[model samples]
Target: MSPNSTDAMKTNLGEAGAHLKNAATDAGSAIKNAAHVAGDELRMGRSAVKADLADSALAGIAALEEGGGAAREQMDQLMDKGRDLIDSAADLIRERPIASFGAAFAAGWIIAKLARSGDR
Candidate 1:
């Protein structure tokens, strides 16, 4: 081959190698940038999930507190009703002492007879 042609071929080969190197460098930079962006997105997603879980837990606690208050109020009302019933019974017993005593004796005798029959 002529010297001029050989020189020209060497120059072309060098230019092609330089272009290939630049393309590889650009591809590496793009891959690194994509990985960094993905990492940031993953971190943000985790933060959002953590926030949502905390909100749900707070809502559950509030609901439980409200329910506990309602249960306490209901228990108080039941205790008040029980006291009224006991007071009523005492007043009735005081107003009818002898009749109450005789009625109680009859009830006790009947219960004893029924219990004896069940044992047999």
Candidate 2:
């Protein structure tokens, strides 16, 4: 080949190699930026999920507390009613001792009869 042609060819090859090196550098930088962005997005998503779970757990605890209060109220009402029933029964027994005794005997006799049948 002529010296001028050889020099031109070498110059062209050097330019091409520089362009390829610049392209590779740009691609590497783009990949690194993308990985950083993905990591940030993942962190944000995980934080959001944790916040939602904490909120849900608090709501559940509030609901359970409300239900427990209602249950306690119901238990208090049942206890009051039981006390009233016992007072009424005591008054009735005081006013009619003989009749209460006869009724108790009858209930016992019926229970015994039913128990014997079940045994058979």
After superposing candidate 1 on the true structure, give the runs of residues whose Cα lies further than 4 Å from its correct spot.
1-21, 94-103
Error of 2 at 118 (Å): 4.2
Q: Could you give me the TM-score of model 1 versus the true structure?
A: 0.63
The prediction achieving the highest TM-score against the true structure is 2
Query: Per-residue alpha-carbon lDDT of model 2 for 3-106, expressed as tens digits?
Result: 79889999999999999999999999999999999999999999999999999999999999999999999999999999999999999999999999999999
lDDT for each candidate structure: 0.97, 0.98
- The clash numbers for all candidates, in the given order, read 0, 0
Give all candidate RMSDs, comma-separated.
Answer: 3.8, 3.7
| Per-residue lDDT value at 60 in model 1 | 99
As for candidate 2, its clashing pairs are: none
